[model samples]
Target: MDMEQSRQKRSFAPRALPHEEYFAPGHRGCQGCGPALAFRHILKALGPNTVVAEATGCGEIISSPYPQSSWRVPWIHTAFENTAATAAGIEVAYKVLMRKGRIPEERINVVAMAGDGGTGDIGLQALSGALERGHDFIYVCYDNEAYMNTGMQRSGLTPFGAFTTTSPAGKVSKGQSTWKKDVPAIAAAHHIPYVATACISYMSDLYRKILRAAEARGPAYLHVLAPCPTGWRYPSEKTIEIGRMAVRSGVFNLYEIVDGKKRLTVKVRERLPVSEYIKAQGRFRHLTDEDIAYIQRRVYEEYEALLAEAAQI
Candidate 1:
């Protein structure tokens, strides 16, 4: 076989993603909802022995509605700001039960799920406490860049130049006046055993990260960028495409921090111009050339800084 042929074959090798479905179909999620995809892969990685505490957000509203639920595992509905606290309590309770011979001592992957608003904004205090107290659970933040469940309101995790109900672009100001909050960095600040960033567009990477997070001895955080077609004003079919564009354009970089050391999971050797990502979404349609250029520059600086930082360890 030729060297080129061999390289191509290796590049296209199939991934061994679990076929078991934990997130059932027929939910109310909008077409191409990235969080829905993230949940499926997350559960696949964690397997059946998992308990999820979901915040009152898009995932919660869609997956659970009164008499019906899409989750096949033990799921708890939590308030927007107390998801992590709930998960922490569950983890502690499980330990106590095992100690008292009330429940089996088998490992149970405790997961706290929330949207960006719930994680970076309203739930920050509760999440911080859970992490600081060294809870043995996984916290997954499905960041679609806004309070999408309530109303496409602006969130701290929303990138600059993206329009939303609260941070709408107008003649007076550009959308999202500030840069996106670095939630992964904040999670790492707690010196947790594991912290990582993932995206639905990259399922294999996300799956591997979840597996690692589940195995962490204490306080693992996974921040996943779930592009929202409804909020971003893009076609539902373009969800995966846009997510890939975001990663390739350096709008989001996939990485993991293990025990205070950082490393990139998906390296962007030749980054696509940020315009490729921005121009595709209506939220960024109003951005002028100068605004895009500024954002592009910031993306470059941040990407480079991360590369350098990750290289140190």
Candidate 2:
């Protein structure tokens, strides 16, 4: 056999795959949508005994269309700003049913899923309420940084200097000027049982976190950085690549908080310039050199603060 042929054969070796299914094929997600990939991985970790309460966002629209659905498990499409509230109610109902011998405790795991705009912006109040009440459920935010379902509008989680339809660049200013919200930290502040940040590019890491969160006793939150090719103006194939670059550039990090202690799970092994990630997306095309430098400084500052918090544990 030739050397090239042997190399190709080695690359195609079989590997262990996750044994689970939730989001099925034939959905309406955009090509290479990171959130779609995330949903698949998370459900694999969660297994079949799960019920999802989704908000009125991309996940709901893409997964559940009239006359057909992509979600195999029991799922509910709630209002835009009430996913967390609805999930909390589901958790309460499950406990009540279990106590009354009407439902088996091992038969279902309740989860709430929403986009960044829904969780970080519109539904934040309900999320806070659920955490404070100590509900036994998992809330997953597939954060693409903006409201992509509504024509790429700016959300509170959107990063500085990124162009959205609402925060369009003009003569007076570049794109969105405000920094992205620190959602994981906010979730940690609630002193929930578990809180973590994940990315679609790191499938194993994301899956492990979801599994851990599912087994916890009290409320848990998982914030996933799901890239959007259509909204970010990048090629469909670049979803995973850009998701990895976001973490490597320090713009995003993988970490968890348990019992009020912060822990950094994945560090930037070989740091890359933020521009490499930004320039690849059309949203940041109008950013000047000064703007890029400002973003870099912010990333470093945020990372240092995270390190300090994690060290205290």
Q: Which candidate is the best by lDDT?
A: 1
Could you give candidate 1's per-residue lDDT for residues 25-95 as a string of tens digits? 99899999999999987887777899999999999999998899999999998588999999999999999
* Residue ranges of candidate 1 with Cα displaced over 4 Å: 1-15
lDDT of 2 by residue, 119-138 (tens): 99999999899988999999
Worst 10 residues of 1 by lDDT: 5-14
Write down the RMSD of all candidates, one decimal each: 4.9, 6.1
The TM-score leader among the candidates is: 1
lDDT of each candidate versus the true structure: 0.91, 0.87
Which residue runs does candidate 2 get wrong by more than 4 Å? 1-16
- Candidate 1 backbone collisions, by pair: none
